[model samples]
Target: MAADPPPPAEIPPAGPSSAATARAGTTPVHRLLPVIVPALAVGVASALVLLGISLLAEKLQDVLWGTVPDALSIGRHSSLWTIVVLTACGLVVGLLVRMVRGHADPDPATTGLVDPPLAPGVVPGLLLVTVLTLAGGISLGPENPITAANIALTCWLGRRFAPGTTAELWISLAAAGTIGALFGTPVAAALILSETLASHPGPGALWDRLFGPLAAGTAGALTMTLLAHPSFDLSLPPYTHPHWGDLLSSVVIALAGAVLGLTAVYAFPYAHRFFRALKHPVPALALGGLLLGLLGALGGHLTLFKGLDEVRVLAADPSGWSAGQFAVMAVVKTAALLIAATCGFRGGRIFPAVFVGVALGLCAHALFPSVPVALAVTCAVLGVLLAITRQGWLSLFTAAVLVGGAAVLPILCIASLPVWLLVTGRPQMQLHEDGTPLR
Candidate 1:
C-alpha cells in the first residue's frame, strides 16, 4: 500500500477557544487518551507476533542444525553440513519468493527498517521467508522483515477498527513496538523514533507526538522482557576509567571499523546488480546460498546465522583466536551479510554488522594488549554501525548496550564524530529497484 501523505507543513489554525483549551492541557489529554489505548494494543500484539515467529524459528533451527545433523551422525559444525544447509536454504527461500503472494513485498535489498505499509496478504509470506532465513543459517537478523510484518498488520487492523487514526500513527506504533520487543527496552525505540520524527515537521511538542509510540514501545518491551528475557550485554571486562591514551585508541579503532563498514556499503550496489542480473529469484538465491555456504565453511559455524549469539561466544574468550583469525572472520562475515542481503534472503544487516565490529575490535586488542576490551569493542561497534546503519543514536546505543558500560559512552560519543563525517553523504547499503545505491 502507498504510504499516507505527510501532514501539511502548516495545520489549519485552531480556533482561539480550542487553542486556549489546548494550552490549558484539556484538549491534548483527551486527544492522547484515544491514541494511547490503541497504541498499547498495537504494542502487545506486535510483541506477540514477534515472539511467536521467533519461537517457531528457534524450533526449526533446532531441527535443521541439531536433529538432522545428529541423525546423520555428522558434526553439526562440519564444513560439509554448513555448505549443504545454506545452499538448500537458498533454494527454498527462492521458491517461496517466486510462488508466494506479493513476492514477499519487494526485494528486501530495496527496503529499510520502516517502509510503506504493505498489503495484509503480504505479511504471512514475508514472515515465513523470514523464519526460513533465520532458521536456515542465513547470516541476517529478524529486525527488518519482522518490523515490516508488524507495521503491515497493525496498519491494516487499525484502519478497520480505529478509522479515526492515521496510517502513519499505526506505522509508528508498530515500528516502535517491534523495536522495543527486539531490543528488550523502550529506550531503543525512543532513541530511534526521536531521530526519525525530528526530520518531519509536526504540530505539538515532541513529547506530545511521542506519546503513542512510547506507550506501544513500553508495552512491547515489557511483554518481551516477561516472556523471553533477552539481553544484549556481552559481559566484557568493565571499563572503569578513561585514560588519555584510551581516547586515542578508541578513535583509531573506530576509524578502522568505519573503513571496513564503508567498504561493504560501497560494494552493496554492485552486489545487488550481480544478483539481479540472474533474471530469476531461483538462480539468484541459489547462487547466493552456495556462496554463503562457502563463506560459512571458511569462517566456520561462528560466522553463520545472525551474529547475536555468535558474538557472545567470541567475547567469552577474546584471546582464543589470534588477530589474523579475527580479521578473517570479520571479512568473511561482512561478505556473508552482503551476499545474504543481496541474494534475496530476508534479514537485517545490523546484527551481522555488530559481529563484524566486535571481531574488528578484538583484532585491535589482540594486536595491542594495552587497549581495554570493552572500550575497543564499543568504539568499533559505534564506528561500524554509524557507517552502516547511518543512525547516530542507534549506533551509540547498540555499542553501549553491548558492553553494558557507561564509562565507554564519553569516548564513543567523541569517536563517532569523525566516523559520522566519513559516512554522512555516502551511498547507503540499501538499493533502488533500478540497482542504484540509496544515497
Candidate 2:
C-alpha cells in the first residue's frame, strides 16, 4: 500500500546499516545488545502507527459504504455506484495531490511489500489519501504506504531518542514490524528479509543480525493480533497424503499461473504508459477508475477492493464458481491491479497479487477437478508471485503459508525449482520512468 513518489525510495535493508551496525572488530555481545535493547521499542512504535492509520481508514471506509453510498441511493455493489464512486475517488485524490503541498505521491511502482522509507512529514498526506483509496475500492492494499511511513517514523525516532542506533537499523526494524502487522505473522517479515540479510556483510552471525528485526516483527505481529488479527488460513481441507500425480499436476498448474502472471508483468509497462500518456492526473485517474468500474460491473463486488477478504470468499467455496467465472475474476482483478497502480491510486500490489493468484489457482482446479484443490492453489500462488516479484523465497512463503499445512512443503519445494528457472532472469514489475519516456 504505497505509491509515494518518483524514483522509488530504496528500501534500507538493501544492504547493511551504517548507523547501527557492529564495529569491524566488535564482540558478538556488542552486536546483540545493540539490536535487542531497541527491538521492542521499534516494533511497538510500528504497530501503534499502523494500528492508528488502519483504524482511521476502516472507520472512514465504513462511513463511505454505510452512509455515502446509501445516501446517494446508489446500490453499494451496483455498476452505477461503482463507477461514480471510483471516479470521484480519483478526482479527489488527483486534486489533492495537485493542489495540496506535501500530498506525498511516490512512484507507484515501488509501493508494495517493499519500499524505501519516506519522510515523517509526508505521513499525513499519505495517510489521508491512502484512507480515501481504501474506502473507494481502489484495488490496492495498505502494506506499502504504512511500511514506508513506519520506516521514516522509526528513523526519526531513533535519531531523536536513541542517538546510538543507526538509521538503517531502525529502518529495517520498522519495515519488519510493518510486515508483521500486515500479515499478522513475524514469519512474513523474516522470510522476506532472508535474501537481504544473506547478502549483507556484518560482524555478527546471520541469526544475530536477524535478532532485532525478528524481535520487532514478533512485537508488531502480537500488537496487530491483539488489536485486529489477520490470518491467511482459508479453512481449506487439509492435505493428508502426497500423491505422485499431485507433483506433476502441481508443476503444470503452477507453470500456467507463472505464464498468466507474466502477461501482467509484460502489460504493466504498457498500462503505466497508457495512463501517463494523458500527461495529466485528473483525466488519467478518472479514466482508470471508469475502466475499473467496468471491470467491477462485470466481475461483481467480490473482485473489487484489496482482495484479502475476497480471496477467502473464493476459497471457502471453490466449487461454486464455474471455470469461466474464475477465469473472468482472475483476469479482471489483474487488469484492475494494473490500472490502479499505473494511475494515481495509492496502495500496494502484494495483497492484490495474492488474491489474483488465488483466483488463477481456483480456475485451474475447476478446469481439472482431478487435481487436489489445495495443491493447485498453492503451486499457482508460487508461480504467479515468482513472476510478479521475482523473489523465490517470498513466493515459497506465500504458497506455503496460504495452505497452512506442512504436507505440501516437499511438493512445493520441487515445484519451485522449475518455476524458479522459468522466472530467474525476468525483469521485475517496477517501472523505470515516472514520466513519458521513449517507448
Q: Identify the candidate with maximal TM-score.
A: 1
**1-439, model 2: which lDDT tens digit per residue?**
3222333222232223454343467555654665665777778778888888777877877777667878887787888888777888888888776665465656566455555567778877877888888878889888778888888778887778867555667777888898887878888888877677665554456676677788889999998899887788877777768999998998988898888888887788788888778887778888888888888888888888899889999999999999999989988988898889888787888878888889988898899988888888889888888888777877888788888999998998999889888876675677654432211
TM-score of 1: 0.94
lDDT of 1 by residue, 1-439 (tens): 3332222122111111223334554666666666667778888899999999989999999999999999999889899999999999999999999999999978888888878788999999999999999999999999999999999998899889756556677888898899999999999988888887776656767777777888889999999999999999999999999999997999999999999999999999889889999999999999999999999999989999999999999999999999999999999999999999998999999999999999999999999999999999999988888888998999999999998878889999999988888899899888777777776
lDDT of 2: 0.78
Can you tell me which runs of candidate 2 are displaced by over 4 Å?
1-25, 110-112, 434-439
Tell me how many clashing residue pairs each candidate has.
0, 13
List the global CA lDDT of all models: 0.88, 0.78
Q: Each candidate's TM vs. the true structure?
A: 0.94, 0.91
- Could you tell me the TM-score of candidate 2? 0.91
